[model samples]
Target: MTTPTTPPTAGGGRSEYLHGLDVLRVVASAAIVYTHLASWISGKNRSWPIGDLVNAVTSPLHLRPDLAFIGVASFLLVSGLVVTRVSLRESPGEFLRRRAVRVLPPLWAALILAFAVVSTGLVREMAPESAATALHLLNNAWFGPYFVGGAVLLPVVWTLLVQLAFYAFTALTIPLLRRWPWLPSAVAAALISVTTSLVPQGAVGPVRTVVAFLPIVFIGQLISLAQAGRVRLGAAVALGAVHLLLFVRADLVSRGIFTPGGGYHNVLLMIVLLVLLFMSANGPVARSRWTRALARRTYSVYLVHMPIGFAVLELLVDAIGASWALLISVLVIAVATELFYRAVERPLERLLRRRRRRRADLERPVDTDEPTPGGNRDGLAGRGADAGRSARQGADIA
Candidate 1:
């Protein structure tokens, strides 16, 4: 599908976006789900002392601050890497369509369902904010805490706005940064730090946190772009070390321990995870049918988890002890996710694909000299009579 306009530096591999990045999406989404489950079970508290007792009595430092902080950063890093691949070649129209298809419907469903299922007065609060919050424009009005219930997000979806911005920012700046990648990364980090410092802590803190988060997300993109591709061994060692350091030293910083932000240390951690994901995606580990299937339905899983998890948490609190609730909730979520995927996501995806094919056929180029809408043939990624000629004449980056 090479065309006359694609950037040669893009690696020009059609499977690059499809198989590589999809695998990482599967991995990152699963990690985020477990993290959310853990929070719900513990009533949003992770007692390190008790955690230490368990580590001493049972396994290793599983729920430690250092570990949790890095895990979250890893998610952001994965976001930066995959988003770069996605944004790099997408036309604005295609980008909007893909993003809307991937994010919106499930988000709407989750907002409604989570509000319906969660007791503890969550539904009461969401009842008033549901319509406005679903719009996302008004989500800032209630941002009492970064991941707190005041935000109308099903759970961690608010961070996705930062993700969305990162995608847009990267796309707009690609021509500029493709030549000097470090410039964008540095400025982005500086901006995030400056914005974070300006926001006074308290009621305004959560709302302001979104502003602070942008640069970090961009930083992740820059790090991936800078490496020029995969950064597995070097990135893994660097990230693993930095993540540990940030986890241990988070208390000294103002952004709070095990949370998304602190300073340079946290930003580095996020970048490292992103680089790691990029490297991993470049490999074949996550290209299996199971993982692809899992990635296809990740949006639904994300939406349903909060509301469903809340209901399960209520049940577990009354039945199982709070300590065990997180462990159990994740297992329950996996089963529910499978059902939701088969019942909801797959059917809609197939329908969309069919409609898209029909559109492509309708827009098929005539055999005459007039150009197509985008100045290319329809239905193909870019295939036509000119592909071989375009490839040889240094016109391959279409």
Candidate 2:
């Protein structure tokens, strides 16, 4: 069997070597973890002027309010590029199995843990209706908007929900997307960008939220196409970048650096940077062996950070005092997150892959040695292929 060229952690020699983009992806994930840990590890003291002053600067630093977005948005771009690339190459059967086994399980772990904390009333202030939302794995609207900043448990899972929707659509549409090539992505980006100015504030659902991002995701697909000589890189890059900026700005929603609107434009730029990183990543990224290693563990840290971040922040409050602890807690969480990624998440992923591969091989059809009982032996291979093809088409339904 041909091994695909995806990032491989140190677990197996067979791992897909991570390009710079992959390493960057993990860094973003870790940052999200650190950002949340800042809140979690802090102890509450209402009246400390000195503490307040320190926290004012330190908390934002961990949060990176300046670049809060690049993490999750880049997460989407990576998913879009990688998933679409997989969608084109792999059979639907393999894609679904790998996605389910590789991604959904670990994600579900964080969601369940978060729900447990909420249900038990240990953390009283998370959104109320989020219980139902949590069951859907953060796809539901119950969690509300407060957690949009990646400060809550399973925060990153929100991106996965959008990804699932896109993947579901892409699975069936891949054949068609392959045919027309540019139609789905072009329409998605165009409609979102144009509609952004049209829609009033507080619009909800896909259009108000991630649906608008369809164009952004499609742009990644476009980037991939351009690289393959399917389109002109200069034209795609130029048009895509312009729309991306305008979307990020979102027509002066808040007119501040900290505002979150105008994701379209930010995402556009993020994707461009990702493309560039993927191209020139080797020299700078590969140079730092430790940094690349850190990238490998990023997802693991992301999964564990939500619960741990809060605990760390809460503890930091008493140990170091509110303001100072908050500063130190960020560092502590970053170190702990690295440990978690190395110890738990990465190992489990490798184990699952081994078991999955073993099962898949065992399940492969075994030819019979018996002579043909009739004039023509049954064409089981053809039947199996047809069955698989039908199932793939059916499961792809949105």
Candidate 3:
């Protein structure tokens, strides 16, 4: 869901990482990939043999095709928690810059690759005309499709757009967050609730989608703030509960009842499960080698899975049997995700780290006067040493 950021320390000044969240990311990525390839695609194309097979297998279990979207919710929660944790020590400008660097380049590269794949006619589901023009590609690349009424090049990018909006909200409200801690989330909840109620039924749009999702992210932030001792645990829990209720209300207002299964019941179920997981499972499970490896690439996998994996499945399914085709498609996804991570994600992350280091160095006060051996020349030198240590600490966590 999120790149590993420094986690809050436990009591007694002991620093600990929530490797469990990493494990959850890996699981969430797999769930979404499976949902798309097996559940969603199969549901869409009933004539396909894989569809029949998937339906036969899953129907008895009563699994909802869209249940895997809980993975997206998981990601949003993680983004809020991790991003807020980092933001505590970062200036708003630096936070936005770092977030842009971490998120955008890989997204653009994936869009380019998706455009190339679609142009090759490998993805039978997508019409060539949809992505035939450079302008259309640019629209999707820049996240203009949702606003401008064009098809999104990569459909999953809608979530990233929401994430970007949350980043802006976070940056702008950092001052309030630092002071009142819970005020921004409360205000966001109130605004979203009022806005959704005022809008006409079934008229949910991008604005509503973006606003509704903000509270979910804010829920994550409340948890992080509580962990960091910025907010009282009781207060954070109460605020988080209120935010979750408002989020559910927004969902109900915008989408109404979604289902063969009692209207987004699973959505609330999943969020509850995720919170429980975050509390109980945030530890040793992530220490596994394979788990860490998968977690590291989850973001890259999320970026490319649908666009690339679906194409592979469509291209190969007719030639091979459904099972083999699905297997191969998954393998292709794994390889492509790895490559994307190595080429785009990792490089940009290194650049971000370098930038942070440079900033820290620049911000560190320099002592022009020679110091006595093993001692400070003055209080300025001591202050400089403290500032440098603080900067380094911030960089490490960031």
Candidate 4:
């Protein structure tokens, strides 16, 4: 989640604005939608032509349709890039605050909607007993299945959990990032990442999952540094390549690594996807009003699309057939996302921003009543104005 702002350039130089990132957001959302849609279709009929087409196109390397995890990977890369940009301009508190405001409200709404769907038997992914746990619904707020035990309203929430963890980690280390740019921290993180992988995983499986993904997230941050010119492009690329290798190797070596269907092929696809995304952001895609308007709802689309889309699919698939049902589901998700954005997300974000601004204004220290040396009201150095006035007055007296 990134907020656009006028960022000061490196070494106090001119500003650099990243246009077309909204386009990337839209693409990432669409990729995610397609991924889930393909999965649904494949589940319905493994021999379906459309499902096969999706599998072929999406998983060029691994040949498994599940390689659509590329969408989530791209989203994470975009997030890392944007998060680093925002982090450079914001204090850690402000960074975390904005992240929460942007991410959480819509998420909570989606979780509730998901519960309603499951409760009504609109979707049968979760059992009634699972839904009845109630605390699982609340715990889904934190993506805490590891702590709360296996009850997730929407399975897509695992990505959000990874995202929030990244946000928390970035918020804590943002000061260090700003101070050292990317190289030193990345190197240290890479070392720790490798070391963590070597640690045998038995009881601490969740810890391994977190460690597994941290390197990928760091690759995102490195891309941001390169884009901002805070780090040399070549160096960033080299380090990224190393980190990528480490990630794949760790997965291969560590038995607990989560590669859904594709092995090293999925990892390769992610690398290519990140490269393409970086190139697209730098290209002449250009920011557009239409793209921005839709991109504003991408978060809503992401949060609710899977569960809601699947529910709509199941409801309509028998009546209209799977192909038509899938199209209808897409339309339904689009309309719902727009409504969620306008009715819930935009309003909540605005209210939070207003409140945050008021709080910040109140917390900001006012100029003290005390005067500076030589009688300035504020505690800033005098700029020879008092002496100039005295000289002019003396000349007039003379």
Candidate 4 collision pairs: none
**Residue-level lDDT for 273 in candidate 3:** 58
Superposition error at 97 for model 1 (Å)? 4.3
Candidate 3's C-alpha lDDT?
Answer: 0.67
Q: What is the TM-score of each candidate against the true structure?
A: 0.63, 0.63, 0.81, 0.79
Q: Tell how far residue 371 is off in model 3, in angstroms.
A: 18
Error of 4 at 185 (Å): 4.2
Per-residue lDDT over 60-115 for candidate 1, one digit per residue giving the tens place of the 0 to 100 score: 32333322333345556556644554444445566556555655554555555554
- Going through the candidates in order, what is the number of backbone clashes in each? 6, 19, 0, 0
Q: Scored by Cα lDDT, where does model 1 land?
A: 0.48
Which stretch of 10 consecutive residues in model 4 shows the poorest summed lDDT? 389-398
Instruction: For candidate 4, write residues 142-187 as lDDT tens digits.
Output: 7767654656787776666656777787778877776777654465
Q: Listing every candidate in turn, what is its Cα RMSD in Å to the true structure after a full C-alpha superposition?
A: 8.4, 9.9, 6.2, 11.1
List runs of model 1 lying over 4 Å from the truth: 1-24, 43-67, 119-153, 171-187, 197-207, 223-285, 320-328, 342-365, 368-398
Candidate number that wins on TM-score, 3 or 4: 3
Please report the candidate that would top TM-score against the real structure: 3
